[model samples]
Target: MDIGNRLKTVRQQAQLSQRELAKRSGVTNGFISQVEKNQVSPSIGSLKKLLDGLPMSLAEFFADAAESSSPVVYRLDDQPELGSADISYRLIGSHFPGRAISLLRETMAPGADTGPDLLSHAGQECGVVIQGRLRLTVGEQEFELGPGDGYYFDSTQAHRFVSIGEQELVLISANSPPTF
Candidate 1:
């Protein structure tokens, strides 16, 4: 998928110039231009910052901002990916009307992480490490968890996830209020 095109369309729809978006998102205008041109790929956290500047949720940004029917049951292929080159976030029911939760099956490459910026959002987040190792940082506390481990916490607190060890990290996570 061309995430750069998606981002460009969204930014234009929001009536934001690259300079304005950069100012709002704390990124350089050059960076924004590079991303829009696909000359550079923003990390998940970087993209999140840009979306936050647009006052949009990652789910909303990726959902194409359309009103669509919500399926009662989602097939495996029904999930939409809201991820970057280094990570995979397969979001289920992304277009579900009245969605109150964000469910994602995530996979991170070895040494891949959510980027330098900490992620903060509304509601709560919980997840379980299904494969490999996970390094979860919430507030100033950090924990190294392995398969079968799970966590729950308020989403307002700053947090980020890192893939530890030499293998890919896979997890299933959910955020209330659909923060994505």
Candidate 2:
């Protein structure tokens, strides 16, 4: 797929400049320019981060909106946005409105990390590692997990994720009040 062209189209549709998207995604403005110019191929994690800045999902980015016949539902909430490109999140219930929980199938590249800052938001989050290794940080505590391991924590506490092993990490995660 011509991802660069697609991103440019969506970004224009959203009425945002490259600088704006870079700021929102915690990426460099020059990187955004390179992506749009097809000069670089971003990793799955990087693409996920860019999509998150648009407040869009990987699924949404690739889906053909022309095929949809259903009405759109606009979500209203005062909660903060939470996510990391290090994990490509595949939302499971995009068609459902007023969903109380968000279910996702996440794939992280090897050595992927959730940037330099921890993330905190409303609600609770939990996930199980399905493959590879995961390094989870919650506030002052840190834990390393492998396949079949799981974790649950209050989302309000600062947390971060990192895929530590040589193989990509796969996780099934859920969040209450829909962190996305």
Against the true structure, whose lDDT is highest? Answer: 1
How high is each candidate's TM-score? Answer: 0.60, 0.53
For candidate 1, the lDDT comes to: 0.89
- lDDT over C-alpha atoms for residue 151 of model 1: 99
Which residue ranges in model 2 land beyond 4 Å of their true spot?
A: 1-86
Instruction: Please give the CA lDDT of all the candidate structures.
Output: 0.89, 0.83
Of candidate 2, the 10-residue stretch with the lowest lDDT total is 73-82
Worst 10 contiguous positions by lDDT, candidate 1:
62-71
Q: List the residue pairs that clash in candidate 1.
A: none
Model 2 TM-score on a 0 to 1 scale: 0.53
**Model 1 bad stretches (over 4 Å):** 1-69
Model 2 clash pairs? none
